[model samples]
Target: MSTAAPKTPKLPVTVDKPTPYNFDLGLLLANDPNPVSVPRTTTASSDPSILESHLANVARDGAQVLINQLLTTCAITSTSSGVLLSLPHAQTPLPREKPVPAPKPETKWSAFAKRRGIKPKTREQRRNLQYDEATGEFGRKWGYQGANKAGQDDAIIEVKFNSKKEAERKEGTTVRGDKRREIREKVKRNERRMRKNQRHSEGRK
Candidate 1:
């Protein structure tokens, strides 16, 4: 007995309801107005080949709808390669299949700021600039040849002591190198804090 070969399934060019898509929101984005993935579960079968064919048909239908939508709404451009369609911003907001991730924990500085109600300062403010009384000009507070390190430029620095204990310890001597040491220590502390925050964040992840 001779058996006839099964013919390949013909992909339908016209979809019944036409899968909704927006060319504006960029590529690979086809938004279904009324998602029926739940209803589709009712037709589930044990046959892998049948399931695969159904999926392929559904995908092909969706693609055709998307292509149709693109051709109608988008601005068409022709090139040596082929045709190009410029998609616009998508209006539809779609939710992800998975749950949204939790917010990252704040760093120590940010937490402290929030607790103290401390506002962020701009770079162009008083902290970033210093008024040079000698030249009567506003100069950078920190950086190369900045006002912060003006003590280093002078041959003899006049040191000021806040406490009686500090005065007794220094004995009214010039301490030009002390400022540099303090800055180095401050920078080291900040680096250590950043490293600790990084480790904490990785641990949470």
Candidate 2:
């Protein structure tokens, strides 16, 4: 008597416009309507090598079914490169595995400006550059190593009796000393703001 050939399980490919496996197309996946009960046989489970081969063959067949179904369901479009397949969006959203990132803490100045609706100057709009004769090049007017931002640093600062009046300058303070003091005060203020911002960020965590 001839023995009957062992029957193989055939998985039904999801022919719907948007397959639940839409996001996993890279793996060439086929969707199973009954996810909890996949139609599988235990014929090769006793042999390790046979089981591995069985799984591989099953994957290959599933991939083929998915490819055939996608070809039939998707819209075909002609492009300069070649034919294109327009796949539909999956009705269900994929589950997120990770938590959303925390927002960065803002600086004191940034927070104040945001509340006041004051837009900061852009790179092109800021007027903080000038020609430094010593360097023979244009540089930032107020940053470190900037053009003689403090006229006091110049070899000969041409001072006019009606020249620019420096703020908080003593009655008898010279131009060079007044300029230096103003720069020092600004540096101290920046340091204080930095410390305050750091404390605020730490408190957020």
Candidate 3:
């Protein structure tokens, strides 16, 4: 037997209404209100005569305004009629100055050399001069000509001048050589690292 086809049900559609906006009507009415007169009255007490009280009130008002101005601009206050202002005064005591010691007179290099028993001709003698690197000492070499002719074999030379001052003269040459060697080694290491990185990167690519 043939079954009857089922009837299709129709779906109902719904329409939404726009929402209503809320507003205050009292604010609008207040905005349109008429201006009214306000009654004036004395802020002070009624014990004294009206004329004297009025004058006193005016004086009090003027004084209060002046005090307010002073308090705003400067650190000040008032009790009755007298004005009071606070000022910051330094309380640090002055440092006492002690008498300076007299400056020492300057001595000339030639006078200093002479005081150290260094003769001008002996001081100018450079042929016998030799530097001992092991002891960082400078003296006349044995069997050398000029100043070493005294026949003293191992006499310790007395250093009168500053060794550091003499060392500073040769410091520039020695330091430059060491720095140049260091920079060259650093550049070589950098080049080796760059070559190694280049090879690794080339393999990856």
Candidate of highest TM-score: 2
Candidate 3 Cα errors over 4 Å, as ranges: 1-48, 76-205
Winner of 1 and 2 under TM-score: 2
TM-score of each: 0.40, 0.42, 0.16
Task: Tell me the TM-score of model 3.
Answer: 0.16
Ranked by lDDT from best down, the candidates are 1, 2, 3
What is candidate 2's lDDT per residue for 1-205, written digit by digit as tens? 9999999877565433333443334344456542332335575455577767766655665666678867877788999999988777655456789988888887777788999999988987788877778779888877786654656676776666655565545688887676678778989999987898878767742
Candidates ranked, most accurate by TM-score first: 2, 1, 3
User: Model 3's lDDT to the true fold?
Assistant: 0.48
Model 3 lDDT per residue over 61-175, tens place: 4444444434454566786978876544434444659876876433344446768986656555645667767668776664334243332333453444766745665634443
RMSD of 2: 10.3
Model 2, residue 141: what's the lDDT? 73
Task: Encode model 1's per-residue lDDT on 38-69: one tens digit a residue.
Answer: 22453565446666776676677778877777
